[model samples]
Target chain A: MEPVSEVSGRAIPFGRKNIDTDIIIPAHWLKTISREGLGRGAFQALREDPANIFDQEEFKGAPILIAGDNFGCGSSREHAAWALLDMGIKAVIAPSFSDIFSGNAFKNGILTVVLPQEQVDRLLEVARTDPINIDLTTQTVTTPFQDRFAFEIDPFRKHCLLNGLDEVGLTLSRDEAIAGYETMQAAQMPWFAKGTGLAA
Target chain B: MASRPRTLYEKIWDAHVVEDRDDGTSILYIDRHLVHEVTSPQAFEALRLSGRKVRRPELTLAVPDHNLPTTPRLDSAGHRLPIADPESAQQLAALERNAPEFGIRYISATDAQQGIVHVVGPEQAFSLPGATIVCGDSHTACHGGIGALAFGIGTSEVEHVLATQTLLLKQSKTMEIVVDGDLTPGVTPKDLILHIIGVIGTAGGTGHVIEYRGKVFEEMSIEGRLTVCNMSIEGGARAGLIAPDEKTFAYLKGRPYAPKGSDWDEALAWWKTLHSDKGATFDKSVRINAADIQPTVTWGTSPEDVVPIGGVVPAPESFSDPSKQDAARASLDYMGLEPGQKLAEVEVQNIFIGSCTNSRIEDLRAAAAVLKGRKKANNVKWAIVVPGSGLVKRQAEEEGLDKIFIEAGLEWREPGCSACLGMNPDKVPAGERCVSTSNRNFVGRQGPGSRTHLVSPAMAAAAAVTGHLTDVRELME
Candidate 1:
């Protein structure tokens, strides 16, 4: 994971509410065994029209995306996050995000900023003509016009994005704790692992 | 001091905590991990790159469902047929190789137990009460029906579980969605859940763990409860749970993975304590009258775009929110529907009665009952019934449900999530409408440019016979 601190770039204004994972990357693109090269398939359905915002020259390789409320509202596909990352999206600003999508984005080093609807609307308006800035350190999103909005994020997520912490390695460091729990679990709840055995 | 009365979610979360970090995140142990082909190949590749082995292989089960075709797998001469899609074939081949290489249990696509991960988990008793189950598929919440703490994770988290069997997590707020009155006739669990999502909106349950309670759920069958819990994700919740009871016990008893004899008795004692205590409070609560729910179906792309079968298409202007109004208009355009049109008058070209949401044996029986002695309407171009698993298909055949479906002019196909996501070749053609028993009705969910209307198996069968979104009650009449 690449460490992310401050992202300043042109932001794509895609103000569509309930923009689900299926819309981000349709199910047809999920067949590949490899995760690379998903940017070509990102938002494929909406990009069918040449005038779609994602493919526009002005927003090409935009690092920030300003979207409407309840973005990424369906599906737990990390491919949605990978697709956005592949397309050079470092941060997404929305009024709200689905729980699973927020987690996925965080795991992949993409920042999910949740502002109020009015703040998001203002950003969407400003994003059309100017660059936007996201400062994870200050926990704020700023526009070129001096518009600023503070957003809340989980503190643990903030640390991870800032440090590019590998979660599996972090959890692996707590192996002793996990083994201790297992030992106690075996004593108190033996039946829970009763049928767990080597694969036949 | 007396201990605080914890809700079911809190109890499960507390029990599963391996360590509580200073950052307010807990390392929660996962008891069971279900794997599928599409979301897992990348995770496996990462493990191989990192030289990491699966920490607890016995706790993981892998199967191929998303990209596997539901059509017959063997040729007439008994040789296996090759998957037509190259990308899909590569993914399936990866899972078949990865699972065994990691020492995990692998159910082959040709095996009797192979099915949608959500369906296979509960059927084999691999998902048990008070356990934490994680899967790469969103509908993994289906196992919550039997009182397990189950939710979906992304590929990164899948790798986390495979390496350590723990997830770094914050506790979700608890919400109780209680339904009291008896559901009206022909209003199945699917209808109830669709109506619930409609009331709550798609984001209503965000950041909350919902526990279904009251008279309605208590009397519901295990399969019915599973169907309701299955759509928790569509309603914006990570998981949905129902307290374990006699029906839950009965559903798991003597299954292949369930505990035996002394273990069963001991497990039952602990399971009986899985429910919330009297006076236990939740962060939020909703009361719904079961009778208010009708045979519901989605009228637009989003799951929250649902309307009762008796209702008419709603105008975009009818929505209170401006953004919703815009979305409604776009949905109407994509769905090729007009405002004020009768929902039942809209014809469908395809009818799909299978998914992790509604392909269990009970679902098959419900559809078969509706299709018995009735021919599919001539206008319906393709009607198919794909069972959830080979075992489910065998069970349906033993019950003569397959014959009933075949005689009704619907193709009886093999299993593996056919047409649910249109990843396989069983897609509803572009620009056509399908009444699907699957969970999502998102844009092009069945296929690019395809329109989907989510409904129950009975309602899907009703639409198949009538060639329109008719209420299942009318067919029963």
Candidate 2:
């Protein structure tokens, strides 16, 4: 994961709502254990049209995606986030997002900005012509015409985005606390910890 | 001091919290972790790179289903056959190697216990009431039917759980969906959920964990409840739960991983108190009349495009929102549906009757009942019945359901996630429509250019026999 604080780029004006993970990267592209080269499969179905927005010269490789409500609404495959990152997308501005997708994006260091529908509509409109600017420190998305819209993000997630934090390492640091909980759990609910090992 | 009235979700969540942070995130312990081939290899690789051992390998289970072919894995001499697809073979091999390397228990593809992770979890009693389960697949909410707090996670989180046996999380708001009246005879739990998604739209439950309430769910069998909760992701909910009852206990008793003897008694006492307090309030509430539900089917690419079986394809203009109207037009175009076309008249080239959603023995029985004395119509080119797990397949065979399906000209295949996604060899061909019992109807979900109409197993069987999307009730007469 890379730290992300500020991003300025032309946004792909994909205003389609409910663009699920399948639309982002189909199930066929999920065969590899590696996360590289997925940008080629990002929106593979839509890219087949040749004239799709993603393939257009102006939007290709754009670092930001401005979408409609409920983006990434199906499937828990983090390949969707990896595909976006591989496509050089640094941030996504949407009216709302599926909880799992939003969390996945955050862990992958992709900034998800949630704004009102009107603000998103305005950004989508401005996105077609001019580049947009997103400042995490200020929590605002700005346009060339002085249009500024604020967004709310969880403080912990904001801290993580500002500094690439290894969540697993952080959690592991509290090993003692976890062990204590396990001890208590074992005493209180003995059946819950029955091992699933084959030998057992 | 009296504690605040809490819902079942709160009770379960509170029980699992290891520590609360000042920034509103909690380090929550995960009780059960289920892994599959597709989204897990990368996570395991990350753990290996970090030199991390699985904190509690005994708490995890691995199975390969997403990319495993439902075709026979053995030859005439009973020798194991290689997977025809190289990528799938490699992925399954990775899981086979990684599980043992990490000290986790694995049910190999050839093992009679191997099945779709969600199906395997409940049947083996690995997903118990008051437990917190996480998986790499979205249908993990199926475990929530047993009164567990289960939801899907990304591969990053998969690695996180494997290394620490915990997740950093924020609590989701609670929503209660209540349906009281008795469901009509022909209506199934699949229809009930599909109709609920239709009423609420896909994003209606976003950011909330839904608790299904009222008499209809109480009367539904555990398998039916699993079918309903399996599609919670499609409705934009991370999880959907139903409180555990005596029926839940009966379903779990004597299962392989269930607590035995005195331990069962102790677990039962706690599980009995897993319901919401009488005065508990929810962040959101939705009420529906059970009689209003029909044998529903989706007409477009999204799950929210559902309608009663007898309804006609809707015109794009019928949607009030401009964006939704555009989406409707796009869906109609991709699905090759006309504005006024009746749903029943829409022909399907293939039919699929399996997935985590509807591959249990009861689901097979429902489909078998519909196909008992019937045959697939000539227009239906491909029809396959894939069981959820090896045990389910064996149970169906013992009950003669396999004979009914084979006699109907439907192929009775092995247990795996066949035709649900296009990762495996089983996929609905391009430009063809399929009536599937799986959850998603997104474009290219079944395959590139494939059109999927989500339905129940019985509805899928009804379509297979008639070569079109016919209502199961019509066959009941």
Residue B21 lDDT, candidate 2, scale 0-100: 94
List of chain B TM-scores, one per candidate: 0.99, 0.99
Clashing pairs in 1: none
Q: Model 1: residues >4 Å from true position, as ranges?
A: A198-200
lDDT of 1 by residue, A1-200 (tens): 99999999999999888999999999988988777888999999999999999989999999999888789988899999999999999999888899999999999999999899888888888888999999999998887788888888888999989999999999999999999988888788776654355112
Model 1 CA lDDT for position A189:
78
Q: What's the lDDT for residue A75 in model 2?
A: 95
Proportion of native contacts present in model 1: 0.72
TM-scores, all candidates, are 0.99, 0.99
Candidate 2 per-residue C-alpha lDDT over B1-477 given as tens digits, one digit per residue, 9 for 90 to 100: 989999999999999999999999999999999999999999999998999999999899999999988889888998889998899999999999999999989999899998999999999998899999999999999998999999999999999999999999999999999999999988999999999999888999999999999999999999999998889888899999999999999999989999888989999999999999989999999999998889999999999899999999999999899999999999999999999999999999999999999999999999999999999999999999999999999999999999999999999998898899978999998899999999999999999999999999999999999999999999996
Model 2: residues with Cα > 4 Å off, grouped in runs: A197-199
